[model samples]
Target: MEFDISWILMGFPAAFVLGWLASRFDLRQLRRENRSAPKAYFKGLNFLLNEQQDKAIDAFIEAVQNDPDTAELHFALGNLFRRRGEYSRAVRVHEHLLSRADISKPERERAQHALALDFMKAGLLDRAEDALARLEHTPYENEARLSRLAIYERAHDWPQAVQIARLMHSHNQGDYSVRIAHYLCEQALGQQAQGQLDAAKDLLQQAQSEAPHAPRPRIELAHLQHKSGDPVQALGSLMALASVSPSSVPLVAPLMLELVKTDKRKPQVRALLVANYHSSPSLDVMQSLVQLDEFARVENADGPVGRDWYVEHLRHEPSLVAAGRWLAQETLSHEEHHPAVQRALDNAAKPLTRYRCAACGFEARQHFWQCPGCQSWDSYPPRRVEEQ
Candidate 1:
């Protein structure tokens, strides 16, 4: 209480020295912690680059423990877990980050996306869908919508797929007209299966209107028409398709051949098949032309026979399939061995006739609008492997 200026001055200097020492100690400790966290993170990254996932995960765990509040560290660890197929751990880490209220908006969205990815990896589609739904209006909206589209497609929820596809198309994300058409076609098929012929026809017509140049809608519509006992209309649809998408003529040739019941339109059908064959020379179209020619030969004895077309095809291209087809119809000089030769040729030509996926190289006897192996649309070309 008494005035002690000398004592007060000594106490002030001593307090200043203590404060400086304490601050230096704290700064050193902080620097050491920062260095340790970075070291662990880098170690994890190095392990990952070396393809040592277990070591990388261990290192990441250490880094996360060293910096519990680091959102980026949490993200890295969660991603690592997801990549390692430890989806539960990945979910826990991302959920922990999401529970932290101190994270920024962007960080929260990022965590949400990560959590959705974890759910997807875990095959918790319902949960993944719910998580993805929350990402709308965020930066991850487009990606989330695409993921949801895949989920809808997988579930065969064509209506939902169509809705999402239309939304993406309207948003200028991408031209989903073809995809929408496919969804409509799928729905049409389902309707057709349920004997809702009129409804199926309506959906197919809408699909055609949506993507006029697409081949599947026309082909599907023709099939439905044929199924509905309107062979004439089906033939007309297929003929129009040949004009619109010439590359699809091969697909429609068999259907056209089946629908040709009247002798009056035989000439017109023959001309279309002949024209298509001249342009593309598809084996399927060639087969259709041969059948028509054989029918014509029965009408006029002087007309060229069906087997003559194979020779003409051979003149255009050296095709094993053509050779085999020609040989099958030919009267071989050694008739006794013909059966064995035919069997060998048929065996060799079988695989070449299979359609192959352009995306995944999955070969099938029948053509597919979508590759079953890769879940890719329009992956398989309309033509067979030999033509390719």
Candidate 2:
């Protein structure tokens, strides 16, 4: 053990010098890489800020080429491609990032999300859905599920939409009960179309259970009852709807008026309409009350005619629709030109009958449970444009 003292003393200094040289080499290499990536990245960022998207993409592509291991550069390049509508190139970039063995967990999830977006933009919905499904348990789960829900709705797959909606609800994403009810209603409509009335009824009942206050299920059930030759039951359902959802009286009023054929339910239905109109004044409710009054006149009840009902409605809301409607029935002094004046006023008031979406400003003559422009469920208010 005493013979190697000289060699051991000399070897320590040699090893230290060798280590220092190696460290310097590594530092120099690292610095060169740092310079290359940052220069290209900053150039790309500058171009992006200037709104020169094509030039920004070129700079990012160059940065990614200079540092192939830089995941952030790849993400930037991939997102740029996607935003520019170059789905093929975006898919290639994101897929390349996902295929790498050394990508971090967060980066991998990001790549998966980017890949899904690329497929969605490319209109490859099946691929996009599969890519999004893999994001469960990750931070992107909520966003992934929301996109999946949209896909399910766009494809008219109510079962799948219901599945995702239940998952979202369980996770406390938002109040999805109404959304679940809408899915059930859509399923019921499908069953009804297939001549499966019993199945449809079961679905509607489930929907009502899911969202008890939702108006569509109640309204739809009344329609089904009426079609089944059970006008009494139909009238009962609408009455229940009016009682619970007074705001929707306008929507149910016409149906109530139609169901009130005999004098037995005439007073009850009339009283309900008047009560609802007093609470929530609307053009639809007013018109229905007028129809009920007209019925009373035909049945030799002690009520005034339809035109007088409009005059009563005008007292509460000062509605142009009510005014125009009343003018239509009155006999003007200039009788010869009354027809032209009435026609002009009626044409002007026609737009007041439309239903407009609260979410997207889409207007339609018919009220919708979903907004066609924005694809939002229950976006249209129960009231017509004039009442709104």
Candidate 3:
């Protein structure tokens, strides 16, 4: 049969009209969807601003569902979940983002970082370490390395801490010399505990070299030397420490007193103690001097006698501790009540003898290089609480 050209011409306009109507319908639907996504997002933002987290999360979920390809929405949802302590949900959201191959490079790295944060917050340390390790050489490298360093420190993995610290130092991230020295000192302590004396000494020496002005390495080295039955080296280390870091002399005062059996160094030690005491007037250094003087009185008549150091300290500072020490040796007019007064004075001075953390104000009977409360290194000053 022959086709009618009129029929073909009639069908063209009809199809064109139908196609126009369909296109209009699709455009309207697309506009509705686009409007709904933003509406949901803005609603979630409003809820978040009002601190209604539950409603905000619901709105965010609705927005994400409507626009699943919105990477920012996914990030916001994941961060919210993490903030709310729903680490599993946060991890799932970030992992889903990572699974999608359509995301850009920066987005992918951001997702990885968020995923690592999720693992860290969930206390999955090994998984967190793995995730953070993948971020090396990325823009987030420094932050990841610092987090790993903290993890190593919290785990007492001093060797790993040292490694990361050296890397950060080499990269010019910050001056980590003191921190590296601390890590080496920690490693030396572990070695010393295991009876590896020589290895411990070597590590301590390396630590001292790393931070010449830091007092811990020298102090620890002196301890190791003393333990190895080498009083001469121990005295030398302490004496060098007094020269390098004179403010730390109080920490080594008792150790200096222990070296009195090496009588040849006694004059030098007494002079060292006197110089430190005169310069800083530390109660600890004064106590060491008094002890040395007590020993000296036994040998020669011309040696200094009694608790005159306490009187001199009182002359410098109106210290209750000095007064108590002076009263202990003084012959009071009312001798019967002296014991009661002394007991009261000792009780009152007990708190002053404690070491306080400069960062967290945590008081301890003994000094800590790291605060037990805040875990900050070198938080405690060398001086006692009263002195501080």
Best by lDDT: 3
Determine which window of 10 residues in candidate 3 has minimal summed lDDT. 297-306
C-alpha-based local distance difference test score of model 2 = 0.87
Tell me the tens digit of each residue's lDDT in model 3 across 1-388. Answer: 9878999999999999999999999999999999999999999999999999999999999999999999999999999999999999999999999999999999999999999999999999999999999999899999999999988988899999999999999999999999999999999999999999999999999999999999999999999999999989999999999999999999899988988766587778888888888889998998887888887653442423446788888888888887888888889798999999999999999999999998889999998988999999999999888898
- Which candidate order results from sorting by TM-score in descending order? 1, 3, 2
CA lDDT, every prediction?
A: 0.91, 0.87, 0.92
Candidate 3 residue 13 Cα shift, in angstroms, is: 2.9
Candidate 2 lDDT for residue 129? 100
| lDDT for position 43 in model 2 | 100
Candidate 2: residue 281 Cα off by (Å): 1.3
| Alpha carbon lDDT at 321, candidate 1 | 93
Please say which candidate is ahead in TM-score: 1 or 3.
1
**CA lDDT of 364 in candidate 1?**
95
- Give the alpha carbon lDDT tens digit for every residue of 1-388 in model 2: 4597889999999999999999999999999989988999999999999999999998998898888998999989889998999999999999999899999999999899999999999999999999999999999999999999999999999999999999999989998998999999999889888889889889989988988998888888888878778899889998899867788777777788888874378878887876776777778877877776775764444543566768777777777778888987788898999889888888988998899999989999998998999998889998888877
CA lDDT for candidate 1 = 0.91
**Cα lDDT, model 1, residue 387:** 93
lDDT of 1 by residue, 1-388 (tens): 6897998888998999999999999999999999999999999999999999999999999998999999988998899899989999999999999999999999999999999999888889999999999999999999999999999999899999999999999999999999999999999999988999999999999999999999999999999999998888999999999889999999989889888855368878887887788888888988887887776653442433477778988888888898999898788798999999999999999999999999889999999998899999999888989899
TM-score of candidate 3 to 2 decimals: 0.94
